[model samples]
Target: MQGLVQSVFDKLLPPACPTYTGLLPLITTLLQDRSCFRAALSKGLGLGIVAAAGLIKLPQIVSIVTSRSSAGLSKTTFLVETFGHTYNLAAHVRQGYPPSTYGDFAALLVQNYVLLVLIYAYSGQPALGVSIVVGAVSLLGGMCNSGFPLGLLQTLTAGNVVLVFASRLPQALANYRAGSTGTLSAVTCVGMWLGATARIFTTLTEVDDPSILAGYVAAAVLNGIIAGQVLYYRGIKSRRGTQPSPAKKVQ
Candidate 1:
């Protein structure tokens, strides 16, 4: 197992990469102690899942930026998701979980903020986008210094289960209403579903936190819905293109 992890790391990362530099001793220790190996393996998997979560939104971000159109994207989706990430981070912090466990959520939350702004800007509400960016920065700044209660963090974490589920609804509804999925990347939806599924297993193994598990489950369901939408709409467009128009005579 140690050699497996090391070989995977070596293939994935360059020699000078910090991950390669630091992984040897840790992998060696995991090999020596049976119980320690199991725990460390779980934790390592969990951390990898967390890190992958941070990049799940990249496809969406790229679609919005290079395409310069937030057409099929949902501002509400990212807004609610951002809150979910923030609350999750807060809960983990209150529980005194190692920062590494929650670090990706924090990073992903920032990316979501950028996504929200890009959505607004590309959708022709530049001022609103700018305001949202400023507001988010201010809100984060204020929350950082204020000591948060654990109870509140727990409540927020639990509440996020519902929020995360609802987060994808707006985009799904928009696709339904427009009869198209817009510019929303199918990659983002599929990646999110996969990531959430992986997180559920990793969380159960490593974190064993029910609140977090609940959120991941809810998120996975919604991501599946969005992925379904992507397929459904693609078929709809394809059939439309193939069919003859009513006004035209079939030759």
Candidate 2:
């Protein structure tokens, strides 16, 4: 029994042996610049979260592409997601902050772009058109930021949030109830969760603004919700005594 338990523990945990993993260089850099340690750790954590979320969404993307039907998804969610990322990018530029330093914004940019492509291929012209409009807004948002226009960034950010709560969240909830994601990619959802986790830590460590900190806290809560969904779906898949759905099959 002891031997069996030891074997289970070994299987569950990563090997203790250290290798020249990518994080080693990062750790060395942080050690040299102790002052930046918190920020670096936060960023690294955020990146990991984003990566995890992206991986989780793979099944949904595949399902959508293979089925060529978005029967269970909501168009409004994607619409808002596209705009939200663009606005976030614009907000960063307006603040003279590098998007690369902002995990949420960076992840959102990649996620929204991929979402647009997937929607176009799976859902057809209407979805593609909406994506294009959102993409344009995102581009223009950057331009608006170049001049550091007053109120523009705020307006965009506010609009983006409203759309997310009013449209995206509701649609996501509905999709959850449907037991299928329609055309929405599960990998993207997972990526969003991971990104949110990373962003929370990053924001807490990197930024001093009280408002931004509060926002990061809020994002953490949202990420929790997204992660819960992923887990729930996974549980459902497992309960049926069937093979886990491939990430490609989820789209």
Candidate 3:
């Protein structure tokens, strides 16, 4: 019985895993090892964020599909986002970090591509969509290939701080100007903020890569801005809806 229990935990929390590993120490120490415990918790939360990333954008996708319109959606926003995420994903994979540390980049890249295609196709520019996707894939894919330079990847990843700001700024500005978050899913915006914030902790605890850390910090702040816009607009919309309209003129 003891051997079976140890064997299961060994597989579950292998030493190669970038977190608190052995179950016996965790149990015998009564969780008194603060650093180890924090690492374990961070790892768990990182994995949770990764799992949520897989579906985090579905709400926005559904909103656009149901409305049959990509109104208020920014093509530049998604395009730049794809560009940033692709680089981030490539950098992380090449850096050999555990997937838990940067899994959101992969998931978000796919979601952003879908959004770009949908926005283009619905806007009557399917050819442009195909072109952009192919072009981006070819260009970014080639850069990430073998013989690619790590120094360049590091520079690009560091630049993601700027890219993250650019990606979120337009959407937030659009919401401010329109006084509405049209077809933007509150779920997706809020999820982005939460995920970005969580990544900050996980990055600190796990990888501690400066470029990745800076990017997540910027992402958290910027995503918060967009999420705040969503909430503020929603409140305004609700209040307006509740306000009594002027009594209809008596016939």
Candidate 4:
């Protein structure tokens, strides 16, 4: 049985697992000792978040494509949020934080751009979509190869509180006005809310960056607002469905 576990770990785990980067050592020693409990828990949860991130936005994407609508989604919100993630990812990488803490941002970044393009495409703005794709590729490629200043990355990440509001308020306001989240997927909203909250805990455990911690804190609050809207609107829908019909007049 031990050999089976080792075989599976060898095949499934990444090449860096043996490097004693604090994560694998924790896993290996978890039963042998009870030290670093918080670190172990954080690493486990962080990896779970990364694994879940790939499919976190998938339902929303599928819903938009199936309905041919981008009704409740805000393009600007996604665009700005993607920018925030890009800057955060850059900072974490340059600062040499563990990938477990920031890996989800990398995964979510790709998904966000895909969703953004779909939004533009369905909104009849193919040119805008193409422009965004080109801009992101050129900008990120250059930043990666060239010396992306850590100061700028930190500044951008520090401003993520404002970025969070910018990314969520418009969508929340739209939901308020429409009395519905429209085409927004409840699964995605709730998932993101949960993710943000979990990120706050994990960031505290694994990362020492104040900017990243603050961003996750703000994100948790804003994401809760959107998720609350989903539940609130859903309840309203359920109540309306149960409303009694008025009696018809005698003929």
Candidate 5:
């Protein structure tokens, strides 16, 4: 069975594009090759992280859409964080990372932008929501296609570290103030923590980009903080013997 799968992957990927192979299938193949198993494992983990990164924000998006409220979401945080993802996307592209590795950043950016727009729209700022959507698309397009300065790209890449903190701190604080997660998906918080933690190792393995590594490390720490806040707030609610408030009207 393993041999058959390997044969299929080889036929599908071809010699010219070994990097294009799916990570798990590649791992299975690597396990078959004793000499390079460690290296293959590392690369496989990195690819898995890349795939996971694309979905990290999904719970938050779904929570907002289903609840029709961006409660517990910080607009400023998401707006700034979306820029972080945007910068990461452009930086990854500029550095010539394979699409298999970095393409999900594009998907992540788009989804985050959509969430941002939704937040604004829910807040009764439809015009602002539309403007952010347009502005982010335009900026991302220019960054991807145009020959932007290397220094600027580097700066943006490095700035991702700060953005990671900026993104989650407000949300954490909001949770603190509200005394509840308040429509914030516990799944989102926990997933982010786990994902960011895994990203650190996977990044060190595949990307080995200093800025990107720093970004993931900081992101992991911040996400851990947010997860801690969620747990802490949950405890507080339990201690106070208070049940959750009824849902707010969907704006």
Candidate 6:
């Protein structure tokens, strides 16, 4: 049944290129029998939904780079995300598992790295200094494991989530209240939303760790809120555009 579902998802969204090729045989095998098709389709649909969510972050990413400003970008969220992924990596390492299993580690690494660069480009020394401090702490936590050290590492990991969510809440609320995303890039917002959605499904379908699942869910909700704000702002802008401006009185 699982195999059948995977096959359908493969057919609809179709894994990107080289990756999908490897699964092609498994997918084909399931399709050969009619009885398994429905189950396969169900699984495929779930995967598709996740895939759609993953695409949401693309818009936000593009917007930040193109505009060269972190205007609406929240440093705290990225900081928390970076720390969270770092902790996850440490946990995987401690358990003798590969880090890639978490998926978000790679995405977070890229997102946080690029964000730091963008922050530095616009905000300069202070931002860079903060990034350095956070990165240093994250690095130490991931590498060292001694008596009390292990406990400290675990704390850092847990703390990352708290800091990120706490930091993001205000910005999210501000965007929602203002009904304007301001300098926040539309591309990045969309991409982040999709990525977050995908991450949620990825947790549901792929990951097993309860802690990781919790983190992903938290991130997903935050991303969804941000996406909602951007979409709402766009709707308002569109409506205003359609409405005619009041006529000026004759001099």
Provide the overall lDDT of each model, using Cα atoms, as 2-decimal numbers: 0.73, 0.57, 0.83, 0.82, 0.74, 0.59
Model 2 spans with C-alpha error above 4 angstroms? 1-34, 43-60, 103-107, 124-148, 158-164, 182-186, 241-251
Q: Pick the candidate with the highest TM-score.
A: 3
TM-score of each prediction = 0.76, 0.64, 0.89, 0.86, 0.78, 0.65
Candidate 4, pairs of clashing residues = none
C-alpha-based local distance difference test score of model 3: 0.83
> Across residues 118-234, which tens digit of lDDT does each residue of candidate 5 receive?
889889997899898899988888887757786798887877778887887888788778777876667768877887777676566557678888888888888898888878877
Candidate 4, 1-251: lDDT as tens digits: 66666665454343333423344663765556444455666777898998899899999999999999998888878888887777777778778877888889888988888898899999999789878967876666555553877788778888878999999889999899999998899999999999999999889887877877888898999999999999999999999999999999999
The stretch of ten residues in a row with the least summed lDDT in candidate 6 is: 13-22
Q: 180, model 3: CA deviation in Å?
A: 1.3
lDDT tens digits, residue span 1-251, model 6: 76777575455542222123345664675668443444444345445543443453455556766876667666666665565656666665665532234444545455566566666567665567466657756584545454335556556555544654875686797786776876676665666656555655555544455656566567677767877787788889889999998999999
Error of 5 at 40 (Å): 2.4
Task: Tell me the spans in candidate 5 whose CA falls farther than 4 Å from its real position.
Answer: 1-35, 238-251
Q: Quote the positional error of residue 57 for candidate 2 in Å.
A: 6.0
Residue 235 lDDT, candidate 5, scale 0-100: 76
What's model 1's TM-score? 0.76
lDDT score of residue 3 within candidate 4:
69
TM-score of 4: 0.86
As for lDDT, the candidate ahead, 2 or 3, is 3
Better of 4 and 6 by lDDT: 4
Model 3: per-residue Cα lDDT over 10-83, one tens digit each = 54442433333356665644367566567667878988998999999999999999999999887878988898
How big is the RMSD of model 5?
6.8
Q: Which one wins by TM-score: 4 or 5?
A: 4
Best by lDDT: 3
RMSD in angstroms, all models? Answer: 6.2, 12.3, 2.8, 4.0, 6.8, 7.2
